[model samples]
Target: MDRVCDGIAVITEGKKGSWVCDGMTVRKVVINPVKAVDTTGAGDAYGSGFVAGLIKRPGDIDYALRLASINSASVVQQIGAKHGLILRALPQGKKWMHIKVEKY
Candidate 1:
């Protein structure tokens, strides 16, 4: 985890999830299901949100976690890694992308 502090590592746990730490402070932890889609590039989306939050408001751990969580959730709802995902900014764009989830 300390390696994450050096900006050299990011942890990804299959059953547990991913964790990023800075020196002694834990940056982010993301948990995903064991059975899911390909999950390719999912980490990119997560990292992007995390970095964006960090840049927008540095040291705001809670806000960064929330943003990363929302993005991660969105990524898992698709059939492929990057399908059925939408990114929009309010005011400029108020459109909606309806995604149906089937529960068994």
Candidate 2:
């Protein structure tokens, strides 16, 4: 997959963890411990987390992956797909920490 794309992140479920490949670099994301209740919406959770991380952390694939991991973990610990969605702001020390989102 890395051969075709500039970077690729593979999300794993059920304690298997995740992996990321960005041409020259390959990294692993460890799963944080969380009780599982439902598997539905895990992908959406991961996508949202990844986008949030990209917007918040920019240029840091590792941070984005961790955010994705966190989002997915949170979702699976609840009953419904959107039940456990928790959006986190960028790190306090970040330069672009003033990102704001308005409903459209």
Candidate 3:
């Protein structure tokens, strides 16, 4: 938070999960595991999903982060960046609801 400019900072820890900092508080959200065939485009999926979630439901930080996790996990499960073609088309409905986000 000290070094980041006036904006939210998202730090992902691969399979472990991710930490989000907003210059004040830091929130950690764990991700569900998936068999990664290819890690290509996982980061891109996460960023796009997070932004899409925010656009769909502004001010819902948890929703955005969860969506990001879901997106990345989905990408890694498939082979190559082609999985991105189905981005939001993932069939895991309400998947994020089952994921527990540790309250800080």
Q: Give stretches of model 3 more than 4 Å off.
A: 84-92
State the displacement of the C-alpha of residue 83, model 2, in Å, after optimal TM-score superposition: 0.6
Model 3 lDDT, full chain set: 0.77
Model with the higher TM-score, candidate 1 or 2: 2
Q: Write the per-residue lDDT of candidate 3 for residues 27-93, one digit (tens) a residue.
A: 8988878788898888888888888878989977788888888888878888887564445454457
lDDT scores in order: 0.50, 0.68, 0.77
Q: What TM-score would each prediction reach against the true structure?
A: 0.56, 0.74, 0.85
- Model 2 clashing residue pairs (backbone): none
Using lDDT as the measure, the top candidate is: 3
* lDDT: worst 10-residue window of model 3: 83-92
* Clash-forming residue pairs, model 3: none
Ranking by TM-score: 3, 2, 1
Top-TM-score candidate index:
3
**lDDT by residue for model 1 (1-104), tens:** 55325652446443355555545455445443434555665666667766676777797654554455445556666666676343543112311112111111
Alpha-carbon lDDT of model 2: 0.68
TM-score of 3: 0.85
Clash count for each candidate, listed in order shown: 0, 0, 0
